[model samples]
Target: MEASFTKVKGGALVLKGEKKKKHKKTKKRDRSGERDGEGGKKLKKNLEHEDMNKHGGWWQTTNLAHIVGPVALQFYNGAYMKALDNGKFVLGAPHDEGQGPEPEEILMAMKVGDGKFSLKSGFDKYLRLDKAARMVGVSDAVGAMEMFDPVWEDGKMAVLGPNGRFMSVDDEDFVVFDQDKVGPAQIIRIRSNREREDMKKTEIPEELRGNLYQVETKFVKKFQKFQDHKLRLNPNGVAELVEAKRGGNLHETLLDRREKMKSDRMCK
Candidate 1:
């Protein structure tokens, strides 16, 4: 995908894109702050305010094992999603850091129709999959990719993409890779190292051996081990995806970076 030139706003990279649709009003939330579904039935909010304060901010992994343990999301210069002109979004890292995510990284977690939410980026662009619906990107067009289902089963919260895959990352760059892209996929494992150490292998029930991990597949034995992360809401109410492991040499695959640079050159 072709990348669009970014404008530096307050010394931060701000992606330029089509304007976002102005919301007439925020979604109607019950007294408990729960949003209602299309039928007007109350649906659970992803992260309660209490949880947000305790955990930090949106889509951040606060699992005990991740916080002080070996596993942590790599936050090099702080990561944020950037959309390219060719219809692909890159999770750009090595960005300037101050307090939290930059204004451009703050995404609006709008309650679109149904119980799902659409992420509207600071560029006023909606995050959606490509025309083929395989790769994810931000666009002005409002399509299926913009709409994502919030799956909070097994004591975990995950955003189901348009391709029916959950947002996940592999050993590769911070760019999200669809777990279900190939076969049976694992969602997330939300257990701290201490919790895992406290549990007795035999004493723990087969079902609850770990804190909370999900596998969605039938007859597929092999699945990728994914760490569950929580999405936190900033004071401004914008949500940002956090990582499990922090500080990773700010690794950006040369191939991927080259492709993006090529796109940028073409854009000029």
Candidate 2:
């Protein structure tokens, strides 16, 4: 064996050692493409939550302020159709088994948002004198106005009728002593604008179903916070929409949701 002496230039060591251990690397997940199969379902769920919070749908956007304006307008639409066709909100929500917003009601809501007419902040609480002045902008004034109800009593303001009745400054609507009877009786008698009976496939589409549910859920939750606020407004919306309607009881009042869910396809 020949032994060779190594000559080092500039004191640098060069050595060949044992092999190094290979470490495993974890993979990074791409959530966007991951939402397929079971992953897809989870992605859908997350997306639904995001959309409901920011972009609420039409009927949902129809808050109390919006409803009163649209209601007043629908009354006009009904009166117009009634004149042109017979008398009632044109394209009224169908009467009978289906208890829900009608196409005409939807149309009226659209029309109101279309800039055809606008309301002041306190429009709902407007007295006969004020509402009368604003009546010119409304299409039909005939059945638009009426005097019905229980007067609202406040130390500052007092009204008397079934507390409140739909009325016009220059007109009068028939009064029903029993509140329970009138809603069902009249609600069932109206006609809807759309002939489409399948509410699930009718008003809202399937893809939007999840988002719609989110809107209602959030709104209801938010509305609950207004308990003390309700006692303040003319008739607290918090009271009527939230307090007045409770679990199970609220479900009983609305039409069979499962049945309705099967047909409604609308979402504005």
Candidate 3:
């Protein structure tokens, strides 16, 4: 090995032939990629949850008079009514808390008459009261035995079968219409996947549900006393209508706008 020379503080020469120690450079890990991946996964999960809630979440029906759609019946035992493959109906446990019922557990309720509904299963079979007094899913078409009347009282609901008996769940988890009166076993919660109807939307006329300008024009044509049918609109923008809509006073604001134009018949 070649000897190298080093000068000390006192001008003394020292042999420095040792090889230079090489150090391995450690590269820092890119945590931003992992963080982005995790954030993307969380966003996707949240979007999936919101989409599921849009069409699959359960909501208790406050009015039994209008129970006509896809629904699930939950018994007092925390089980949902389900249709079996063997032409029978049973109460099955939910998979998780706040989870909606499965496809087999969903029933299509058709309003047959006042307070009467016909429940059809996912198998396209109508639920009927068999001769054995058991609720079965074997009928293809709705008949007298398929008609059910839902009764709501004190925020509770009960199903009355064609035989004038209340539907109840047995110890074996089977559903039957053998009870004469509504009891704990007979009480059920009718849940639907449909969104609740907004009372405000109901109060607004169907034709007046467009933009503010369109609503104002329609109102002028409907309530204007002038025979010329000319629309007299306020020169000021519809900013007040937008605010009124958010405050649930859109109708009053529209009337005020029409009164300012002197075109409303009821303004006087």
lDDT winner: 3
lDDT of 3 by residue, 130-230 (tens): 77788898888877888988776555678888898888987787899988767677788887777666311347576477898888778777876775766
Q: Which of 1 and 3 is ahead in TM-score?
A: 3
lDDT of 1 by residue, 2-36 (tens): 01112334664546985655554545434324423
Model 2, span 200-228: residue lDDT tens: 34464332244334433443443333434
Q: Where does candidate 2 have its weakest 10-residue lDDT segment?
A: 151-160
Pick by lDDT: 1 or 2, better one: 1
CA lDDT of each prediction against the hidden true structure: 0.40, 0.27, 0.76
Error of 3 at 126 (Å): 0.9
lDDT of 1 at 166: 59
The candidate, 2 or 3, that scores higher on TM-score is: 3
Candidate 2 vs candidate 3: the lDDT winner is 3
Off by over 4 Å in 1: 1-87, 92-98, 131-138, 170-177, 181-268
Ranking of predictions according to lDDT: 3, 1, 2
- Shift of residue 12 alpha carbon in model 1, Å: 54
Model 2 TM-score?
Answer: 0.19
